[model samples]
Target: MPIHIKADMAASVWKVLVEPGDQVAENQQLVILESMKMEIPVVSFSAGVVITVVASEGSSVLEGDVLVTLSDDGETG
Candidate 1:
């Protein structure tokens, strides 16, 4: 099954750490968001392969927005 990464709060995307196809470990930082003068990191909950990154730097995102997707084996299809 695939895992969806969502924004926890409304913020501007600060940075994307991994691109699609990158192998990631559990708790790896995927992106950082800037909100209310604070930086928030979005992390993976388990080891997996990045499937997609829907967020770009400088993009504004709202809470619950889907930012990225990952699979346990790194395959999207």
Candidate 2:
């Protein structure tokens, strides 16, 4: 199964911690978003191998924007 991680709110992407082909665990921080002077960490919901990273640092992202994709079976995208 594949999972798509999305932004929960509109904000500037402050940092990205995962990349394609990286292994990620459940609740691991994938990206950080900055909004209204607050920093928010975006975490993974389940363990998986990252397939893609779409968010970039310093870019504005809207709510529900896809930030990362993951393959739960350890497959590379």
Candidate 3:
């Protein structure tokens, strides 16, 4: 299955910590969003391999926007 890690709130993308094909563990930080002078970390909810990174550093994102896409074992097809 594909897991989409989304933003919980509207914010500017402060940093992107992971890239496509990176191995990720549960709770691993994927990106950081800065809003209202506060930095919010986006984490993976499940262990998987990053298939794509939809969010970029210094970009603006809205709530529920997909930041990263992951598959159970590095295979999305």
Candidate 4:
């Protein structure tokens, strides 16, 4: 199974901390979003390997937009 990390609101991507093939733990920061002059950290929901990054740094994202995909470690195809 794959988990999607989505933007909670419209914002500019400040940074991407993890890339494809990187291992991430649950509640770990995946990316940072700048909105209203505030920086928000986007965290992962499950422990897994990063499969893809849909949003890049300096990119603007809307609410509910997918940021990254994670391949769950315990899941099987």
lDDT of 1 by residue, 1-77 (tens): 88889999999999999988899999999999999889999999989988899999999999999998999866765
Clashes in predicted model 4: 0
Kindly report which residue stretches of model 4 are placed more than 4 angstroms away from their true locations once superposed.
74-77
On TM-score, the leading prediction is 2
Clash number by candidate, in order: 0, 0, 0, 0
- Which residues of candidate 1, in runs, are more than 4 Å off? none
Can you write out model 4's per-residue Cα lDDT over 1-77, one digit (the tens) per residue? Answer: 78888999999999999988888899999999999999999999889998889989999999999999988974322
lDDT of each: 0.92, 0.96, 0.93, 0.91
Q: Name the lDDT of candidate 1.
A: 0.92
Q: Estimate each model's TM-score.
A: 0.93, 0.97, 0.95, 0.92
**Candidate 4 RMSD to the correct structure:** 1.9
Compared with the true structure, model 3 gives a TM-score of 0.95
Candidate 2 accuracy as lDDT: 0.96
**Tens digits of per-residue lDDT for model 3, 1-77:** 89989999999999999988899999999999999999999999999999999999999999999999999866955
- Candidates ranked, most accurate by TM-score first: 2, 3, 1, 4
